[model samples]
Target chain A: MSHIPLEEGVPGIRSLVMYRPDTGKPLYELAQVLLRDESPLSPAERELIATYVSHKNTCKFCASSHAAAARYLFDQESGVVDLVLDDYQSAPISDKLKALLTIAGRVQEDARTVSDEDVALARSFGANDRDIHDTVLIAATFCMFNRYVDGLATLTPTEDAAYAQMGERMGTIGYVLPQKPA
Target chain B: MSHIPLESHLPGITGLLEYRQDSAKPIRELTQLLLRGESTLTEAERELIATLVSSRNQCRFCTTAHKSAADILLGESETCEMVINDFESAPVGEKMKSLLAIAAHVQKNGKNVTEGDVIRARNCGATDREIHDTVLIAALFCLYNKYVDGMASFTPTDPAFYKKLGERITTVGYNRLPGGYDQLKTQS
Candidate 1:
């Protein structure tokens, strides 16, 4: 009953990473800049937002992978991820992070939904202008990323262990092309 | 200068979650199940789509997190995430991803973008009724998440470290709560 011809036999990262290199040059460059560039937000916080937003969206791939990464950052603290995933307002975190996540949520729903009060709250938390700017970019970019993955009818690994392993490698290596699927 | 009260933070998963929990929540729950539960689409692909849609919506929280996670799922390969953050045409995958990006673009711009050609392209990618179902789900979530984050005005962390942390987080675990911020204030 599925419309797309999903190559289920491909297996894990190998199957998902099978995009044309030439086709993805620009996107690759942008992602590199966004993830690796010198910005105000920490890598962990940024990724946390991504995971949180994905969870809100209920994107399984995003929620699982980001959750693993978040756990790695906080030393396998599933509670932190759960807090954000379950209810950011109730999550035990800095006011600044809460402010940022709040902004991220707005980006997920509607940019116009972001109000002046939101900016002032972020300011109170010591978030600078650049940090605020980057937040918008991160939110915007995720929207694109989420659609891209889901749109393609791409494969998701069934095993939780697989995501954990992938998280371990990703945590250390960042995003480099793997030779084969682990 | 702000219209809403900066101090008035909405507490605890919004009353919406609680209300839905009491009843058999339909919309959000249905969306969550479709997104996280078993389906024809792969987890990575679905995340990719979610990330892409969030990115387009400028949802820093969702996009950055999912990008890193997507990176891991792809064996730390930045290609797919890259394609998502910027150009969709650049390929490491299929036309379907690109097409869905188009759908996200439509979502970003508004309903005016649902063109005939785009629909045809989605069809070509093997996307069908279910795929359409998922796409709508992905698009709708970004809208909701964006509304929450934007209005609340949450901050985003830096990038270099964000990526580093993302990679480092591969093995730890999931769903944690680090206590520091004050409890949510109820304003009813």
Candidate 2:
């Protein structure tokens, strides 16, 4: 088995956060607000979006961790989650969700890449201005999150169990933690 | 006068787009599609989110170009665009707009971020899915745009007229030759 380098092991932006967890408190707090905050999107849907982008970016750690979070949200079979990650349009979701995910893909590209036709399609599915705004925000944020993690060569736990553990923690306690292990 | 470093002195991302006219065609095309793609977001709003995130990341070139784009869509007299970029909560359009701007700020951070603050902010107007999807998309693309410009070290350029020029270029043709200098010529 090939041993991964120490610098390349941590997942997401944990290293950057860990290095300045004290300083990053504000940032972490903000994240909690965004996810746990009141909105139409459920925790599961949010995680699913993150998972989708992580999968697209091919970030192993984000993919695993977020996937675990999403799986925890759903009480049924994991096939649907898998399908959403693979191809959201064909997944077992409403037209609204399909429209949202389509916007997410555009976010992965350039904003200019998204077109009026795309907006009209979503509108046909009944996506309002708020929904549109949030979609762009999510896509744009993930881009930065992905970079911050990959940029620092953060460690990504490979074990499925590890991510599962994380999922439980996130689901139960939200994003903030009393103590974090380095 | 301090001479600009030859390497760092390229116009800007927009300039490079013009400079490397051929290669940039793809990104320009991609930008157009993204701006007008089938999403819930409007072209102006989408561009605003992108510009805000780029500014937070401190990418001078992207900030310049996207802001220019925002100004064009929103209008030159719009101070709210600046408010959004300066701080998501700096008193802008509406609760929904604030939510989107805040989402962009969070994107500059990382995803391990969820708390009552963002929730409360979104609750003011944003939906749960909106917050979630916003963060996801913003975070994902920040990586991409950054990767491209960072890797190639693309120059950032946006003039008072650049936005209009970009708008024209975006609408008309990205490659009919803008009628300029040899420096505008790309490596290809």
lDDT of 1 by residue, B28-51 (tens): 343344455555666556656666
Query: Which parts of model 1 are misplaced by more than 4 Å?
Result: A1-17, A76-78, A178-182, B1-188
Measured with C-alpha atoms, the lDDT of residue B182 in candidate 2 is: 50
Where's the lowest-lDDT run of ten residues in candidate 1 chain B?
B15-24
Chain A TM-score values, per prediction: 0.84, 0.85
Taking the tens digit of each residue's C-alpha lDDT, what string does model 2 give over B2-110?
0111233334444434433433443444444445544455566666666666665566566666666666666673553555446545445565465565555455444
DockQ (Cα-based) per candidate?
0.09, 0.07
Assess each prediction's global lDDT (C-alpha) against the native.
0.55, 0.56
Residues A1-182, candidate 2, lDDT per residue (tens digit)?
10112223345555455543442454455446545665467777777777787677666777787788788886585567788987787889778878777767766655445556776787788776545544554554456566445433357777789999887777667777333463
Please identify model 2 stretches exceeding 4 Å from their true place.
A1-11, A177-182, B1-62, B65-188
